[model samples]
Target: MCTVCGCGTSHDHDHGHDHAHGHSHGELHFGHGPAGAQVAGMSQARLIEIETDILSKNDRFAAANRQVLQARGAFAVNLVSSPGSGKTTLLCKTIEALGDQPLAVIEGDQQTANDAERIRATGAQAVQINTGKGCHLDAHMVGHAMEHLDIAPGSVLFIENVGNLVCPAGFDLGEDCKVAVLSVTEGEDKPLKYPDMFTVSKLALLNKTDLAPHCDVDLDLYEANLRRVNPGIEVLRLSARTGEGMREWIAWLRGNLGRKVPQAAE
Candidate 1:
């Protein structure tokens, strides 16, 4: 099974040769030596072709979802981070900062709806998608949930992707931008370790600055690593718990939403 996408099938194979080798059915067979050895090279090639097809299909769906969101004038933001990285807390702060503006949240988790409940407490419309054992939320799931939301045409929709750095980066949730959340407690080298997450993200939120005084996290090193992977990516240092640097975060969000909503027609 593939650990990244959680989409792989286990199969038993029989090798007619002295050396044990496994091959999937419908694969090419290369005749081995003068001993009539059965070649199973085609099976491996088939597997690669199937994997490519699956990813291409998924990419198509993601593009369609993006079009739908854009047509509705929705500013969708995908939040990604490790578990306990304070995604919900930052979302709550964002909701509060939006004030009377129309905002909706789509919370993704492995099991419980606890994060969605917390988001709803902030008076924003919140929907939770429990992915069960799945590590990431794909475009289809987000597109489906969008229909059930009460978001207005020009609303801001925040999709808090499952708390994971790897799989989520591989799956696009049809969002206008992906915002990666890395708490100070998670250390500064996270960007270096998870280069794909940082590279694809349009913005990086370095949360828990309030605890910086107590933790050994080096802010400079963290920012340096993120820049190394994506020099153009915006980085924000904030503490959701203490509300530090929240205004700037809110301002950034408002600016994005404002651009999408358009100015008053004279």
Candidate 2:
């Protein structure tokens, strides 16, 4: 089992592993570890040690992936969100808006090649990575996917991470920046609920705005909560279905493109 997310390490099984046995409280409580996750028959200290080891190995691969992108002068962004946040739709629209500018997509899902096919239909190069039981895409997986892609110099690579808000936040995939996508239908308090995801993201897109009025969502509150979680995160309200705010979204992408990602401090 993965110490970080408590899911099976193999990708051929279900993504989330639900350990039925909870604490003696008759409910599941995962507060047993510094890592905030618990696995049966594992001590908190042991879990922390294993998680550190996993992340350290992942970081090495991430550094290598970053070096490869930097050498090609390519910019990469890891798009993360929960399922049904319209992340794939946003990517397809972004691909169309960027018409001729070099672009490629890395689609990460627990199963199926649907999203990758959607990206390819936009006439952009795409690679699909299916992590069957893995909760999120790791640096090693992204590194392998890059090998199958013909990423152009100065191109923009959008890595659409598996639909997950928790696990993906802790794993860096060597992207220049992380972008958080939240649907208005998902509630305005999402930023507060998933603080780590918003905190690590460079930009937050409040997607599916076309349904905001019908959904009775408070867009202002969402922006306020996002700012509360990440003071410097750029927030944009856009509906990929309606093409609302896409120009600004596209412009933001262009502005960030070609900028070198800084190396992590030791």
Candidate 3:
């Protein structure tokens, strides 16, 4: 039982054969302790302590990962959003458009290796992190991933976090910035409803603009809501499938990538 976060902990550390975060997840049972005695006996102070400890542990891991990347002068971006927000497609397009500049990806999901496979298809080395029953990717998991991947100096590492809005918002994975991908098809009120995500995000990608005309999506209302939640958040109207607004995304990536800029030819 994890006194911190109450999410429990696994110290098996099975990293020999599997991918990053080789955790032996424990089965979750409802009600705290035997016959729910612990839940009834637990004080509010204990719960607060747990939360603080959990976050602090995660932050320690995040800090170490940040130091490593900064030392190498590499850029790390965490891409987060709800499921089916075209994040994978956007990454594929970004990788292809960037054109071979030492790019690697860490794909996080609960199940299959499909997303990582899709990313590798675009001509970049990629690895998948399967977080079974886990809604968010924490810093510890990402740190493990960095050990296996070749994220060298002046390279770009994109960590595609698990599809989640609430949990991922609070967890810091040692990223330089969080890029929120919100699809127009998801609805205009998402930003207002999930304000925490927008607040944490440095940039919001208004994806699927190609389908905006077909759907009754209000771009203005979305803009207002997003700005209300994150006053200074940069936004780009884009469509990953159609090759629209991709140049701007590349420019953003280049500006954030290390000291030496990537050559136009490669």
TM-score of each: 0.82, 0.88, 0.83
Off by over 4 Å in 3: 1-5, 9-44, 258-266
Preferred candidate (TM-score higher): 1 or 2: 2
C-alpha local distance difference test of each model: 0.79, 0.85, 0.82
Error of 1 at 99 (Å): 0.3
Error of 3 at 142 (Å): 0.5
The CA lDDT at 44 in model 2 is 58
Candidate 3 local lDDT, residue 188? 94
Candidate 2 wrongly placed segments (more than 4 Å): 1-29, 261-266
lDDT of candidate 3 over 145-172, digit per residue (tens)? 9998998678898999999887788788
Clash totals, every prediction = 3, 0, 0
User: What is the model-wide C-alpha lDDT for candidate 1?
Assistant: 0.79
